[model samples]
Target: MEILAFIYFDPMYFVYVGPALLIAALAQWKVKSAYAHGNKYNASSGLTGAQTAQRILDAYGIGNVSIEAAKTFLGDHYDPKHKVLRLSPEVYQGRTLSSVGIAAHEVGHAIQDFKVYAPLAIRNGLVPMASIGTQFSFALIFAGIILSSWMDMPGARYIAVVGLGLFGATVVFQLINLPVEFNASSRAREILQQQGIVTAAEDKIVGKVLNAAAMTYVAATLTAILTMLYYASIVFGRRD
Candidate 1:
């Protein structure tokens, strides 16, 4: 039973990871609130997210990019691997601030792809490694602790260190991902105003939606960083 007690639930867990957890919680609320507000207001241009995306693509002279409808609400994304931009059903059809803001933001990623953005490339490369680490890093850390504590294993620290290194990949991925998301939002806001998709006053509402979404990413990155710090503190602090 003791061996199963993971470090995440331990007292040190709160000390290292609590604040970031609170930020994540707050960001989720902010996203919902902002999205709801933006959803209530229809765009003056009467263009749905799909149409807005097409206009942005055309303005940027980016052709050959496909825009498709995604099934879920707020599940929109740009798939660089497939050269596809997917907007949620609401965004694809609804003519509202929230819908167009999200659509424009995703198209920002497509724009990045056209330009061969460096961070996006780095982020894509890290996806496979991060996916693997997220699933097993904690288990490896726990096993390393149990082996050292209960079995008196000499190489337990090495195993734990390996887990820490694996965990670091997640942190690196999140850090690189931050700028990518922020830049997308920045581009979205600019083009929306330039094309008169939204008046200057209406653009503020779009900012609310985009900023709230950005905070979620910020919280995720902060959480990953704090988590890595906690793991390193425990694994290396007791070097004997």
Candidate 2:
């Protein structure tokens, strides 16, 4: 099966996904660079990332969500299911602009949850299907390809089509995720400034960090789109 992946290996796949891959790499580099640079300057508020999150939630009158230190580096995320905002060690403990920016971004999700953001609700609903698609879509695709191309099996193309459809869930998830992330960052910036967590000058630095982080999501969404198109061509363009 490992060899089977290579059997269908089309250079065109790379051609289709190459720009997105480059963008993804660049976005990651930008995130690391921006984070390192922003981490050097402390926010004027003198609040740790955890504190920043708490303050933002307090301002919004959202008391139910709890903030906690996360175990991994750069693993900050909001667990909507548990109403917990988990921050990485750096974000949770540091008082830098990077820390506050990231902390507030997670808090944005909590706010979204409080407001019942429609996109967020829809995205949560798609999570299970996207997970399943990410795990098994390629295997099914390869199996279908081998059956149709090598064994000339009947109805093999249908299997590939089904795999393609499943993989679409991931693309849909990525598309839906873009607005959620952008909205969170927008909310983060606005509330951060309005609450005096970041001075106007410092807000620019926070914007840099948050914008870099948002680019990563954009890259992922682009990658998912290109990957879907690449496989669609393969499955549907097979010689009859």
Candidate 3:
């Protein structure tokens, strides 16, 4: 209780929290603005998201991947497990810049799969562990903290170390995610430009949309890294 109270009142806690919230808000604003601008400009190709995805796959000479419609908004994603690209209803049916850009981005992942992009491969391997780690990491950390305070035992310290290890996995996943996402967007922009799917004039808008979307991932990764660092500081600082 005393340790928890001390940590809670520590000015460093708020120091970290404040910046994280500010960054998160800015990221949200950027994402909303990007979506609005992208939606405002309809694609000249008149190609639905599914169509665009198929065209991209075909352009890359990828035959085995399937494109399908999903139920959620902004739900568009490529699933390597099923070899399917799923787009949200709006994206799947709409012929807007946002639709094509998003579809192409997902298809970009398919291209990565074909080429066996190393980062994507690493991310895929981390998914299961990261998922479990995310759910249990905090519980483990808190338990470790409480047990250490109560018993003053080394086992408690070990448990906390395990918690940190799990959380570290999540941090690594987020970091690797940045490169995979950026590479996918790069592929999307190049293919869109090369195929003349979007014109030179429209390229600016698409670029902004992709760039804005990439910022969200960057922000997420930054937030995760900061959070892990904050926890690590708390755990280690106390020991010294």
RMSD of each: 1.9, 2.0, 1.9
For model 1, what is the alpha-carbon lDDT of residue 49? 94
Which model, 1 or 2, shows the larger TM-score?
2
Residues 52-108 of candidate 3 have per-residue lDDT tens digits of 888888888999998889988888899999999999998898888888898889999
Q: Top model by lDDT, which number?
A: 2
Q: Residue pairs in steric clash, candidate 1?
A: none
User: How do the residues 62-107 of candidate 2 rate in per-residue lDDT, one tens digit apiece?
Assistant: 9899888999999999999999999999999999999999999999
Q: Candidate 1: where is the Cα deviation over 4 Å?
A: 1-8
The runs of at least 3 residues in candidate 2 whose Cα sits more than 4 Å from the true structure, single-residue gaps closed, are 1-9
Residues 1-240 of candidate 1: C-alpha lDDT, one tens digit per residue: 344444335777788999999999999999999999999999999999999999999999999799999998789999998889999999999899999999999999999889989999999999999999898898888788778867989589778888888999899999999999999999999999999898898899999999999999999999999999988887777533
Backbone clash total for model 2 is 0
* Ranked by lDDT, top first: 2, 1, 3
CA-lDDT, candidates in order: 0.91, 0.92, 0.84
**Clash totals, every prediction:** 0, 0, 0
Task: Name the candidate that leads on TM-score.
Answer: 2
Q: For residue 142, give model 1's deviation from the true position in Å.
A: 1.6
